[model samples]
Target: MVRSAYERGVTTLTLDSPHNRNALSKGLVAGLRAGLAQAAADDAVRAVLLTHTGNTFCAGADLREGSGSPAELAALLRSIVELPKPVVARVEGHVRAGGTGLLGACDISVAGPGASFAFTEARIGVAPAVISMPLLPRLDARAAARYYLTGERFGAAEAARIGLVTLAAEEGADGGTGASGKGVDALLEPVLDGLRRGSPQGLAESKRLVTAEVLRTFDRDTDSLAELSARLFASDEAREGMTAFLERREPAWVP
Candidate 1:
């Protein structure tokens, strides 16, 4: 579910589970965690790029995989936030729910115009508890209030304006490559090039300086948040929402 490769001081971890829109199944989480570990252990790898193979960066958790464990999801976000090396998210597709947490955890992210994002948990009768550990700190308060409540999709430009994404590039604007592989490559190269110049210790320490408070928040709140998330997933309301989603209909509680 994850593929890794290293070159020019960056280790790229690409989520490859297109079968379910690259959802965070157990296998994908394990693969992602392992990739982060590998990047941290390698002195030559100064940065990590988190990208995905399919059109959807990640559709949050795999509901078919049995609601998934919120604790596991929390741990993955924590890993990304606490990693000694810098992590950059290259987004050129849709991201939803927990996937947005990954963006919050990353030090920097670049997205193409084609990308769209949503916090869809509320529509499904749950709150964005687990992801809130990182997301609350990254997103603008007003933007968070709107998206978290409505689960509405927004464009990359809006994401950039709200600070959820570092930059958003238009199609063909990135070195005339359009919004494809070459375009993403063009967007990533300069960032990675800049990262390569920082000493490992400097980068690590700088990351520590930035992430300290957020990490503490995670340590303190993850258990309660995971419990809250799990309880919601098991609720009758969420069951109705999930069933309606799969059956192509509005949830019973929807007005």
Candidate 2:
């Protein structure tokens, strides 16, 4: 479900599974890992741009698909963190639950005005356990606690303010105008150009320096978090929560 394109030393990995809002189905995750692997092997590739094909960047785990293993999710997040080349995210729509993990893994992220983010796992009776490995190290403590606990939805600007995203592009304006006038693409042009300008070794080494702590967090916590996630997803509360979400109603616990 991931589509790949190469241009000017950048390999763009587009999440193509719009049917499930690019939910992290086994296929989608495998495809994304494969795309990243290819980019890593290609000397001509300077960076990776992660994007989506629909209005929602990703809706989180494929609750409908049976892969429900948080371990796989951890692996996917780690792959991005360990990737030798920088990974930049282009978020023009909504991101939820584990999708935010993908955003957190990227070296840099650009979110358009239309983008929204939420840690909706709590609503489903599960915590954002696996994702926390990548996110907590970067996000502000107070902001993370609020959103993660309440499952509140926030806009691109709020996401940027909390360090979840690097840039939140302004709303509609000519693409030619500077940051204020340009949308996501315009804001991304310079970032992409900067990546293109960096020598391969320089970019790789620089990325390593920035991502070291993220990798350390992954090494220290991945197993326990994955276990916690799996346990929650299997609990009765989570089952009811998932059913309620699929049925478009509040779970019974919602008073």
RMSD after CA superposition, every candidate: 2.7, 2.0
lDDT of 1 by residue, 63-95 (tens): 887569899999999999999999999998999
Top TM-score: which candidate number?
2
Backbone clashes in candidate 1 total 1
Error of 2 at 154 (Å): 0.4
Question: What are the lDDT figures for the candidates, one per model?
Answer: 0.89, 0.92
- Checking candidate 1 for backbone clashes, the offending pairs are 172-178
Once fitted onto the true fold, the runs of candidate 2 whose alpha carbons sit more than 4 angstroms away are: 172-179
Per-residue lDDT value at 107 in model 1: 91
Model 1: residue 39 alpha-carbon error in angstroms? 1.0
Local lDDT at 203 for model 2: 96
Backbone clashes counted, model 2 = 0
Q: List the candidate 1 regions with Cα displacement exceeding 4 Å.
A: 171-183
lDDT of 2: 0.92
